[model samples]
Target: MTSIEIRHNLFDNPEVSGTEYKTVELIIKKLQIYHPDILTSDIKDGHGVIAIFKGKKQGKNIAFRTDIDALPSGHRCGHDGHTAILLQFAEYIVSGNRPETGSIILIFQPEEETGNGAKKILQSKVLQNLHVDYIFGLHNLPGYHLGNILFKYGTFAAASTGFIAKLEGKQAHAAYPENGINPAKAVADFILALDSFKNDDISNFKQITVIHVNIGEIAFGTAAGDANVMLTLRSFTNKGMSELINNVTSELQQLANKYSLKVSYDFQDKFNALENDDVCVDIVKAAAKELNMTTESLPEPMRWSEDFADYCLKWHGGFFGIGSGENCKPLHNPEYNFPDELIDIGAKMFLKIAEQAMVD
Candidate 1:
């Protein structure tokens, strides 16, 4: 099948994070037809597919990963395009355009939107047994010029975690408010304290945003006895994030004690900051130069978080961005869609990188 057709097929049938059974099935079917050499759809616990293409002479085992899961809002993140790029690249490898030496592994990872897919894949014996020497991945950037490649040397993205704080107190009758405890004041104070955790330092890149707040419901006759706050915390470094989390926890505990309320908190959607290896980044630049494609070096790391950081941490690799178009809608926006033109561009880039890795 053509790359465009495959991309549309994956985009039309969207699956939310953690449930990509049909997506995996379709990917496996295509890989079997195109590559057929090494394909594994072995479902143990996590959802993912691995395809290996061995070359004439073995040198280094290089892997390229692409996320296969879509957001609850649908394929607004362009994972469909990413997956199609890898699939087409696989087709290129198997159609006698194999690397001169070494092998290539294509990974279709699941649940990336939930921030646990890469971790689960790494833990699974499937990837651990491959012993990949180098890994690479890419995401499409909507605001850049079409076909332009963007690279960063270190800290490509931020470390982030979803913070949730809950408080409980005794409800009080409206007529006699002092008879029981009310948590409204505690919630208000906690919000203020949480905001205080945001460091204004430009280098640290720390931020705290309150996403949700809830107090006891609408029956106006009773004072609110319980409250909760949901926040997203981010930093450029893990140390900075740890410090912010510790400070927030300490302040929240103090506020709970002062207000005489029971308190509990938990974190979700945790992501480590992405640090790109300098050597791997040079390979991307060289590949772009070889293709005569435009390239840009970002001045600062993106505030968004990506699970690809997990793979880069384990292997000496780099993750870069491909431009969708200058006027295209941003990722996760309802109007956003992956452009069909990027399929060939991304696939060629990955193929070039694989060739370079084989020779280097």
Candidate 2:
């Protein structure tokens, strides 16, 4: 199958985060052609695929992972780019030319963009049974030159937690403000409250805090029976993240009560910060250098969250960002395409990483 066509098939489907059946099914089918050993299994109602390749000499079990899910708007955030690179790499590995040593586990996880797939996979017995010693993954970075790898020694990406706050109030004529509990004011107050709590300085702590509260749809003619605000909170450290989330929640409650509006909040922990192990970094860097690919350390923690953090928690693993070049549009942009040249390098990097980890 043409890689472009595969990209289209995956890109066209807006698998979203929690609901990623279409894309996962397609990836499973594609992998089956090369590796009949591939298995399509479900994790807590959602699907996650796994395939294993044993080496000539048994040393340790190593896993290379890739996410097989897209965003809500579909093609945004370069999911298609990631799929293309991963598929290319999968093809390369299935060609049966790997070095002799530890076994390889190829994990095509779902809902990565949602930050749930890694956690779901971790909960499963498959990963635990494999006893994977090292985990390696990569993502496409939009702001840099494509095909370049940015690796960090410590935490590379921030922890992202998002949720929606639903504010319920009495709806009445706009003419009488006191007669009706207008939620519009509550929404405004919530926005102000979140903005006031924004912390942009990284030097104060391990990483900066990012808080975004955007007002969703609101009916103006009506007094506003319902109003909602989508909140995105991010920070480098788990403790900082906890504190930030608590502050936002508490402030929201106060604002809602002040306006006499009944409020209920549901917080979904989307993703945790991606912290890299130094040992994994050294191995991957050496692999990149040997392949003649330039590598650099990340300057600051990526404010965005990645589901890969879930994998890093249990396994000695790391995830790096591959530059998509300055000319390339930013991630989640409608006009985004994965650079084809980077596919080979990514494959080579993982292969080397697996080899190095499994060596006796």
Candidate 3:
């Protein structure tokens, strides 16, 4: 099947994070045509599929990774295109267009949107047994020119996590104003404290966004006894993020103590900062230049978090962006769709990178 066909199939059947069984099955089916040495044990869990293509001679193992799971909002982040690109590249390798030496490993990672997929895969024995030397991945950028390659050295993306604060207190009847301890004031004050945590300094790049809040049911007779505040905390560096989390935790603990309420907090969907290795960045640049694709250097790291950062933390890897189009909707937008034109460009880029990595 063509790249467009595969993309349409993936886009048509979208699965949210941690539940990509059908998606994985479809990818396995498409990959079967190539007849590569496929691994499905890790894929059985929430991990993902790993396809290995052995070369005629022994050499290093170069791996290219792509996310398989779609967002809750659907394929608005263009993961469908990302998966299609990798699949098309697999076809290229199977059709006698592979390296002369080393093997190639294609990783179709799942649950990237939830930020636990890479961590799970890394902990598994799959990648450890392969002994992968170099890793590479890319994302489609919607605001840049179509097919333009964008790269950034060092920190490429921010480290972020969801902070959920739960506050509990005794409920009181509405008629008896001061009968029970109310957590409403504490919740409001905590949110304001979070807002105060934001910094305008570009170097620090700290932000706290309130995503959700709940204070009880719709009953009018009883005062709210419990409250929840869901927030997203982000920073450019892991150190900075760690400091911020520490500060937030301490402050929340203090607030709970002051209000005499039981408060607990947990983090979810944590994404580490993406730091690109210089060698890997050079390889991507060389591939782009060889393909005559326009390249752009980003001035600053993106504020958003990506699960690929987990891989970069463990491996010598680089993550770049391919322009989707200047007019395309931003990622996660409800109306957003992955562009079909990117399939060939992305596939060619991956193939070139793999070939370059295979070179001595």
Candidate 4:
């Protein structure tokens, strides 16, 4: 198969936010071409696509996943590279393969950019009905070099939540300050209050905690009727995150009330921390070792969050990120791309990991 062409196709698809259903559908069609028996279906209005490949021997059921969704920025986070690896691997596995141990389920999920797809899938009965023994997932990382695997035994990623705070103020004319309440000043005060809460008093708080608040918009020359603050709260543990969120919310509410402004708060997308089981990590590391690839041991935890955490909540599983290239590019960057060489290595590693874990 032409790996370059597959990569190009995946990258060029442009499966941006909230509309990844079409991309998943296309991948399903491509996989169906290789394995006629590969059953494919859409779950929750194309939010997720499920495909199953049955093995000859009767073993436990297992699953390997890759998210198919792209960010609104489109191709900025190297999501195209992820989809290509998954499609290529699915084709390699289901084409009358000789592995005689267990079945493989390939899931291409949507809405990952918003961190809601996995949670929605968990709520449904589909994954519960499959009785899957284990699950595996991976993401691309620049600067790590291509064709390299990074594995962690536990708590690989942090917990995160996106928040929106609405404030009400009486709008006043730009020239006439006394005519009505000026929300612009209140909004500025609220932002300052939120930033003040970013205290470095607690040890490790600087390393693990992050609080970002930005004023969304403001209007003048009218009664300051509405204002909003968009904030993101994150931490490595549930306790830290809960504490931080509560602290900031209380502070912001108090400041809004002091300014005689009405306040409302809501959370948009939430991603739980990723905790990898020891057995699953061992399985992945052993498979990488067999492939003669140097597996870098990740001893430190990452503060980024992923929806894959939802899958781990149900079944004992693990997730990691591969070094796609050297001089690692941060995610959500337009210049990033998933290295083509890792397609073969990633697929082979996945196949080995599956056989090792499920094929008795």
Model 4: residues >4 Å from true position, as ranges?
1-3, 36-38, 56-58, 95-102, 123-125, 171-190, 193-226, 256-260, 327-329
Error of 3 at 328 (Å): 1.3
**Better candidate number, 3 or 4, judged by TM-score:** 3
How do all models score by TM-score? 0.94, 0.81, 0.92, 0.83
Ranking by TM-score: 1, 3, 4, 2
Q: What total of clashing residue pairs does each candidate reach?
A: 0, 4, 0, 11
Model 3 agreement with the true structure over 31-56: per-residue lDDT tens digits: 88888865553744684788888888
Steric clash count of candidate 3: 0
- Per-candidate local distance difference test: 0.87, 0.73, 0.87, 0.72
lDDT-superior candidate, 2 or 3: 3
List of clashing residue pairs for candidate 1: none
Please provide, for model 2 over 93-113, each residue's C-alpha lDDT reduced to its tens digit, 9 standing for 90 to 100: 677755456667777777777
* Candidate 3 TM-score over all chains jointly: 0.92
Give Cα distance to truth, residue 208, candidate 1, Å: 1.0
Poorly placed runs, candidate 1 (over 4 Å): 56-58, 200-202
Q: What is the per-residue lDDT of model 1 for residues 86-170, given as tens digits with 9 covering 90 to 100?
A: 9999888877777666778888999888899888877766576666888999999999999899999988889999999989988
- Candidate 4 local lDDT, 228-324, one digit each (tens): 7777777665666788788877876787777777788888778777778788898888889888987897656676788888888888887877887
User: Per-residue error at 107 for model 3, in Å?
Assistant: 0.5
